[model samples]
Target: MAAADSEQIRRRYDRLAPWFDSLEGILEGLLFRRLRKKLWSQASGGHILEVGVGTGKNFAFYPDGARITGIDFSPKMLEQAQRKRQRKQIAVDLAQMDVQALDYADNSFDTVIASFVFCSVPKPRRGLKELYRVCKPGGQVLLLEHVLSSNRFMDFMMNLLNPLVVKTLGANINRETLKNVQACPFRNVYTDPASSDMIKLIRAIK
Candidate 1:
């Protein structure tokens, strides 16, 4: 993906930062919170890295004693996350960083996590490769992502609407994230349906 595209996404997210939580509040209350908990529960809680930690929606779910570092490309989004962190007194290191170009050293984290993030990343495969790079040899990669549906009609609709969705929300509605994860160096990849077949709980070993 081009640098311009990545910067565009960052700008879009920064613009959305103030309204993001309220915009997704209903869905979060009804479903996302449960999925977040399930995803966090799988964490080994040792030197974790969370990619695209937007507005710190997962802050409440961080495991006890987990050494966490959360990164995002949008500074405004990180600001929202920081406020939440302070209010909750969560122990997390927050940074402005891109998943596709992580600054961490090789084999740096015990667990790497990304939730609802790949769809917005300009280069999903590149981001996944970075996750594989930063994670320890035996560490885990946990993801909660929504993907293109297997149903032909739904897939077609998603493809049709994806451009508009991305333009307005800075997130693509039709990403093939599970396949992207498989294409990376990670091993023992596994997926389970978190909400129908479209939304998946993907787990892989690094």
Candidate 2:
């Protein structure tokens, strides 16, 4: 995708920042939080980076004392995340950065994470490559995402809805993320369905 399109997506998210926390709260309660907690709780130690860390929703789920850096493309979202971090007294480094072009050095983090993020990335593979680049050798990447379904009926529905969804929210509802992960350089990829094969939790070693 072009840089201009990516910027537009960022702006959309920034505009949504004010209501995102509340909106996501209801969505999380429906199912997202359970999977988020399950995946995030596995980062036992070492420096961790969360891509698309909107409002730091998974912040509290990370193990205590873990060194964490959270980045998002949306400044307004990052501001809300900062407020949450301060209010909850969570120690973390927060920055406004794009996942597709991370600023961090190679092999800088022991673990990389992203949740419900790839669907909105203008270039998902590029973003995944960046995730792979920043992760240390032998480190792991954890992701919780909703992807294109294997079920033809559901897949058709998601595909049918994707354009409208993307136009409105800048999030595609039919991303084939597990396939993308398999295509990336990361090894030992594993995925399990979290919600009827629509949402998934993915793990990979770098």
Candidate 3:
């Protein structure tokens, strides 16, 4: 991702921080439950690292025995994630950090997860490289991303409405997110095709 684009996304998320929890409260169960199921099934336990963990919406679904660290660019979003944890007693090491620059040491985590996140990251490829760099070589990078639909007509509509959409949701409507993943440093990947059209569930090793 370019520096300008990174700043754009960071600024957008910062703006959305106030309503971040409420917006997630609406889409929480339906959108994230599916994400949880697929990710856990592929990679279980072992010091998990989650990037772009907005409002900690996926916290409830992670395994009780796993060690987890979650980071997001928006501090308000992290506060919301902290609020959710006070009651559930889930132990998550949360921080406000940009995806393009991870703070951990090399081979820091056994599993790295991203869900509906990379689309808004300035350099999705750069972020993916950070993901790979931090993962223990055998560990997997699980992604549950929403991509631009393959349908040309839908693509056209998405292109036309992207500006309004990004302003409203802080999301990218026109990112060919799958292609971005395909270009990353991963192998032995698995993607659910039917699910891959709009939302792709992938498991790839570093």
Best by lDDT: 1
Q: Which residue pairs in candidate 3 collide?
A: 1-123
**Cα error, candidate 2, residue 190 (Å):** 0.7
Cα lDDT, model 3, residue 150: 88
RMSD of each: 1.0, 1.2, 2.0
What is candidate 1's TM-score against the reference? 0.97
lDDT of 1: 0.92
Cand. 3 Cα-lDDT:
0.80
The estimated TM-scores of all candidates read 0.97, 0.96, 0.90
lDDT string for model 2 (1-206, tens) is: 66988998998898999999787788889888888888987674479998898988888787776799999999999999999999999989999898989998999999998999999999999999999999999999998988888999998999999999988898999999988988999868987644457888999898
Q: Which is better, 1 or 2, measured by lDDT?
A: 1
Residue 54 miss distance in model 1 (angstroms): 0.8
Point out where model 2 deviates above 4 Å: 193-195
| Rank by lDDT (best first) | 1, 2, 3
Number of the top candidate by TM-score?
Answer: 1
Give the CA lDDT, 0 to 100, for residue 135 in model 3.
89
The reply for model 1, stretches above 4 Å from the true place, is: 193-195
Q: Candidate 2 has which clashing residue pairs, if any?
A: none
